[model samples]
Target: MSASLYLVAMIVIPAIGAAAVAALPRERGLLAKQVTLGVSLVVLLLAVLATAAFDVDGDRFQLTTSVSWIPDFGAEFALGVDGIALVMLLLIGVLVPLVVTASWHEADAGPRPTRVFFAWLLLLEAMMVGVFVATDVLLFYVFFEAMLVPMYFLIGSFGGPRRQYAAVKFFLYSLVGGLIMLAAVIGLYVVSTSQLGEGTFAFDALRQLDIDPEVQKLLFLGFFVAFAIKAPLVPFHTWLPDSGAEAPIGGAVLLVGVLDKVGTFGFLRYCLPLFPDASRFFAPFVLVLAVVGILYAALLAMGQTDMKRLVSYTSISHFGFIALGIFAFTTEAGTGAVLYMVNHGLATGLLFIVVGMLIGRGGSRQIGDYGGVAAKAPLLAGAFLVAGLASLALPGTNSFVSEFLVLIGSFPERPVFTIVATVGIILAALYILLMYQRTMHGPPRGVLLQQDPAEPLSGTGTGTGTGTGTGGATAASATATATRPAAPGTLRVLDLSRRELAVVAPLIALIIGLGVYPQPLLDLIEPAVSATISDLGGTDR
Candidate 1:
């Protein structure tokens, strides 16, 4: 099949499934789960085929599709895939199925479970695919901004106590940032028309147009600010913690896993090559911000007591690494940054899913609420530990390789920033291990020990009793103890269920697989990155 058909199928399949999920009968909740999973799997398969069909060695956009959407403005329905887009598309494909499985229980939870939750999830998948494959700046922008809607609903409706607030904050922050980007897109379109005698939103065409250095700088800032808000570097990052903390586990996974990459991807795809002079001029300042973000976010992550919030802060720090690589302007660093995008999604998405499971079982997100859970839930604990280790970039894990490459690649160009960013790695160890210790170690506290009072006693002789000597004797003892129960003993923690294991097993395998042999992905990304650097008139290192 043609790549354009595959891309269209990627979008339409999920959208059609979403509609089907919305109409499915509640009694057939299992059907909804199957359909959602089926759609996601198909999308993943298509994305794989798209990757296979992609001409990595060609060093030009592949599967090009264009149609005049607005001829006067030179806007076209342009779509294509480079190596970067291919990687991101693969990520979206991999993550959506995991997210579907993660949220499988939600389909059977409420009175109308199949209708709302599954539908929103499918819609979100469509938007994410659109975001990665779009080639026209306007089309990309539309998908970029359109994503906020499904995400807002996902968080607001299916999430935690603060879901409403988090959703609103996330929506507002992204909306403002996107409006700023829209203005910049318009400016770019207008400038192209004035200078080249034709307006265009085609990325390659815009890249070829020469604008004034001053104007380029201004245009660059417009694009930079928008992506910064999404990348959420430093001051613009406040929304992520709240949103991640409150979003449903699947929602949080995609939010951090896929959407956040749009920011860094923007820098690589548009900012650096299209505005080479401005990118060079702004590199130092952006590197400063990226380094500062690394340290600041790591420190903030260290102080977080909520597991989700801690993970969110860690994302901020990871994105700092991506931003640092982009500004470093080396091919190796840039490629590592791209790799970092995929690795972060896998490792952190696993963290969110595991933490969400912990919350479901323990009934709270407070760090003090859990202790010695590993004693009972050894399998779950082990998975959490592995995921945490990956987050901390331990060797033999996917994150370690990407982070190592990024640091080595950036060291020459931004030594001070690289050195400071390395400290963030140290801090990453502190925060991830500290969180692991608090939740999975020590003794259980808080609500892990609550007992039910209404159950009738059986031969076991617990709770209320039937007529029997032992039961009567125990009843008197229980009454006496009810006045002042002894301090809670060690709590029971259940190991991960087969269902839960199914959700995270693939992620663990990939973490190991990619860590041990990442050459396939590296090979795929290199040619396109080299071309991007050459376009900016830089030597590929």
Candidate 2:
């Protein structure tokens, strides 16, 4: 197979699938879901093939294929991948299948049209791949903005009770950022015209232009504001928590897992390369916001009562590290940021799946509603614990490696920021353990702890001298409820269902696998990272 074939297939296959899914008869509910799953898997295969075809050690972008789209404006239907882009493609590829699997029965959840949900997901995947692969700045912006349509509907139509609000908030924030970015794209085109005698949005062309320092800062702000909103640095991060909490598990997975990465990807791909002086000039201010985000978001996460919201806050905290790594201007820090994006997807994606399971059983996302779940479902508890540990960057987990690299690589260049960000590590432990202890360790509220408890508990579980909880069943004792009958009116909870296990098993393996052996990914990422740093005119500190 030709190299362009893999890159082209990654986008085309999903576009074709979206069309096919949209054409499916509404009556064929199962067929719609199955077809979407199959297409996602095929795209994933293409991603793997693309990885195989990618020249990881190559100094320039590989598999580049461009065709004129607008000769008058100097735009084209161009595509290619650097090692960084390849990693992102692979991340999206892996996440899409799992998202399809996680949402296998999601059509049954809300009142929206099931076929539309599947179609939108496929559409989102195509655009995401396009964003990562596009070589022209205009094309990137187009995909960047266009991808929002599917996600907006995905949340508004298939999300929770507050879905519409979250969707609109997400849309408005993104639109504002996008409009700002449009101005920058226009600015770059003008610069290209001044330098090359005709306007162009080609990334390579823009990189070659000699831009004025003042103008570079202006253009960089336009781009930085958009990416910051998307990277969602601190003050600009409100939409994320709202969207993550309200969207379906599948949407949340891509929203937090993949879509958000576009912001950071834009930084590495566009900001640094196109405006090196502006990047260095702005690094200190960006570093300050990143450090603040790491602490502020972690504190907020600790105080959250809702499970999804807590995880969302943690991601914000994690993004702080990603941003810190990028601006730290070290190859190690940048590579760690890239790896962190991939590993964050695995750890947090798994966390969302685990949270979905809990919500499905508990019927509430409130942390106060659940307790002592480990006694009822060890498999589920164990999986949740693994995800939690990964999120906290526990030793021997994938997150540990990335987090360690970010801090260590950043210290020499930005010692103060690195030290402040390190405090998030302790905060991570506090929040992850707190959520686990409350949800998995305490006496469960709704289900029987075991086959039977020593004594059948009465209403509210007050027999153990505790107040009432949400579900019909309640238990306050650690060991007293193992043999008691389920409280009247509450359903007995079972362990992780087969389908649920299928969704999370691969992620668990990856969390452990990458933690111990991250060299493979690092090797691919380091060259690309070195190239990005070189573009920024920086040396590894």
Candidate 3:
């Protein structure tokens, strides 16, 4: 297939699948999931093919398809992929199947299995593809802003107790940011019309039209604010923890996995290339904010008691690294940032899926409620540990390579900021270990733990009087004894089933693979990033 057709297929196939799934009878939910997975796998294969077809030695943008949607206003249906966009597309392709697997059990949770859940998920897959593929700034903006709809519904309709509130907050923050960017989009269109003799929203054409430095800065802020909100950087990131915590695991995965990257992607795709002087002028300030966010979010993560919120905070911290790398403007850092975006999607998406499993088994997200789960559910705990290590950027994990490259790339230009950001790495270890200790280590204390009758014994006995002196021992002992158990001290609860394993195993494999061999991803990203830098008058050769 032509690359353009591949791009269209990425959006269309999932959409059609969503509609088909929605129309299926509730009893055929299994068929719906299978169809969703099949479609997602096909999309992933197409993305892989697109990657293979991408010419790293050639010009910046490749395999483009453009057609005028509205000739009068200079809007068009445009699609293309640079290395950065290609990486994000690959991330989406990988993540959606995992999300479908993660949510498969949810179909049986409510009174009636809502095929609408799968439909929204598939629809979201299409929108995310559009966001990454669209080359026209206005088209990008439309896709960028339109993404909130399916996501909002997914969260609100299928989410937890405060789903409505979290969903509304998410929508409002995104809407406001998009509105600000809309003004900038309008401004760019007008400027292009007046100066270039015709209005155009094509990214290449817009890149050629220079605006006043002051106007450029304003436009940059307009775009930056939208991206930051989407990236959910530091102060703009408050909505994430709540939304992530409230949304179902599938929703949380996509929110952090594919959606958040749009912000960082915007900076690289639009902010740097379109407003080069402003990017340079704003670099130091943005760098400082990025470092501050890294440390701030890490510190917040260290104090989180809710498992979901902790993961959310780590995402903010991870984005801080992506921002720092992008604003640093070095080829290595930029490439690392792009890779970091992909790594975060994989690792963090796995983390959320695993956490959801824990919540599914334990009936609570409170860190203090779980203990000795590792003994009972070794497979699940192992998956969680790998994901956590990836989050902390441990050696031999995917995040470690990207984060190391980011720091090394930024150090020469922004040593102090890089130093501050490095502390976040240390804090990451602390919070992740702390979270693991709380949820997987000591003893099971919550209602879900009590429900497990055959709960195994690991380091210590399952009795309350083991005197480990941990936070949850007493509560877990009491809860465990209270629940129905086949034996006196053992509780039988479900562990990671084959389906759960199917969802997370690929992520773990990729984390290890990418950690070991990131060169291919880096090589592809470097040429396009160099081209971007050359466009900004930074450097390419």
Give the best candidate by lDDT. Answer: 2
Cα lDDT of model 3 by residue, 1-541, tens digit: 7866788889889989989999999778778878888988988999999998898887688878888898899899999999999989899989988888777656444323567778888889999999999999989988898899999988787676577899999999999999999999999898998998988999999988878899899999999999999997878998999899878888899999999999999999999989998999999888877988999999999998888888999999999999998888788888889999999999999999898777655555677656777877889889999999999999999999999989998888778899889999999999999999877777555443433323321111111211111112343443444332333324334577777788889999999999999998887888888878877887332
lDDT of 2 by residue, 63-165 (tens): 8889898898999989988888888988998888888877766554456557888999999999999999999899999999998999999988877667899
Worst 10 residues of 1 by lDDT: 458-467
Error of 2 at 334 (Å): 0.6
Give all TM-scores, in the order shown: 0.92, 0.92, 0.92
TM accuracy, model 1: 0.92
lDDT order, best first, reads 2, 3, 1
Which stretches in model 1 have alpha-carbon errors above 4 Å?
107-112, 449-487
Candidate lDDT (C-alpha), each: 0.81, 0.84, 0.83
Better of 1 and 2 by TM-score: 2
Query: Model 3, stretches more than 4 Å misplaced?
Result: 111-113, 448-493, 539-541
lDDT of 1 by residue, 296-365 (tens): 9999999987777889999999999999887888888888999999999999999988887776554456
